[model samples]
Target: MRPGHGGFITVKNTLLHCYCVCGKIEDAHHLFDEFPQRNDLISWNTLMGDYLHVSQPRVIVDLFKEMCIGGFEASVTTVLYLLSAIGELGSYLGGESVHGYCIKMGFSYNLHVVTALIYVYAKNGEIDLARWIFDGVAVKDVVLWNCLVGKYAKCGMVEEAVALLLGGGLVGELSPGEGESDVVVDPATSSLNLNKSAEESTPPKLSQP
Candidate 1:
């Protein structure tokens, strides 16, 4: 169980992260609910984040509602993952809601947030919107390149996708096996669609969401 706000919460964070990465939602939720520190936005996000990776991303909708009711203001990171979860649901309404919030709050310009937005739009079949976002980015990174390329390839925009993939060579760091590169494996990918569960986990399940 979680104690008062000041003590051991950091330890809880470490274990909770492990639980999330290992697909132990039940244990993660148990520890999360038991924590008195649930009043904090970070605590809620940490738990909410774990729920986003699993197949049941809709869980985040209910949790976000609770977070709002609890008066925890949403941050750029919060909306980023929430958008990812919404994307997994193929729910444009939810995605638009988050996008509206991001724009209203001036988070639309944040690099990672926009990247996630592009992904959500692309995954939801809003390729035009995804391209719009991608085009607006003056200084693009490899992660965005992978996303746009993947989505374009997925959407059958082969020429454009191949062009973008090949264009990376000019950046000099890109190579044949892009996924093996450091930038390709950035933690921002977790912001895509993360939810942890015991069913998909190996031995010693940490959480049960």
Candidate 2:
């Protein structure tokens, strides 16, 4: 630790996290670019997660592609955050591609990874696949059930959401990495409004007198 610095925080990385959290992505990127070991796996994953912190999902995907070119190995956190970004960005194909990557890398059995998978699939309107993943979980919990509920509600699959709420027997489960477990779903404010078609715009025909 430096003379005025805490044991864990530093000017480059810690400060980079602060900048990213504050939505100053440009500054954070500039600092990350200036760092000598920017390609280091730790540095790369930190920046990727930081991009997620600010909701810049597209850039995070691009960054991961670049990381692949550089031979970087993605940790579970790496894929978790990236899957989240894909869901938010509506990159369904990309999310599916990442799911393949998870299977290839043997991370599919991880509960946190599978939770993110369910969220990503639901957000991408692939509820069948999402429920498939959900079903494979032997030990279900509040986080998993709520993740599905929120996505179903946001996607206007109210029937599915109701079914999940009514049928789910939730217990406690371990929280995933930072920020993943803290999702708050408000259907009115979630921004993915696809329910406009369900309003029954055409009136029923009246019986002829």
> CA lDDT of each candidate?
0.66, 0.65
Off by over 4 Å in 1: 1-8, 11-15, 18-24, 35-38, 162-209
Which candidate leads the pack in TM-score?
1
Question: Could you tell me the TM-score of candidate 2?
Answer: 0.70
Writing each residue's lDDT as its tens digit, candidate 1 over 31-76 gives: 7777554446666777767776565578878888888887777776
Candidate 1 accuracy as lDDT? 0.66
Candidate 2's residue-wise lDDT over 1-209, tens digit each? Answer: 23344432344666776787688878878877764443365566667767766667788889888888878877666776677678778878988999999889877766666767888787778989988888877665566677777777677788877677677643233233311333422111221121221111122222232
Which candidate tops lDDT?
Answer: 1
User: Which pairs of residues clash in candidate 2, taking residues 3 or more apart in a chain or in different chains?
Assistant: none
* lDDT measured at residue 38 in model 2 versus the true structure, 0 to 100: 38
State residue 193's C-alpha deviation in candidate 2, in Å. 30
Q: Can you give the TM-score per candidate against the true fold?
A: 0.71, 0.70
RMSD of 2: 14.0
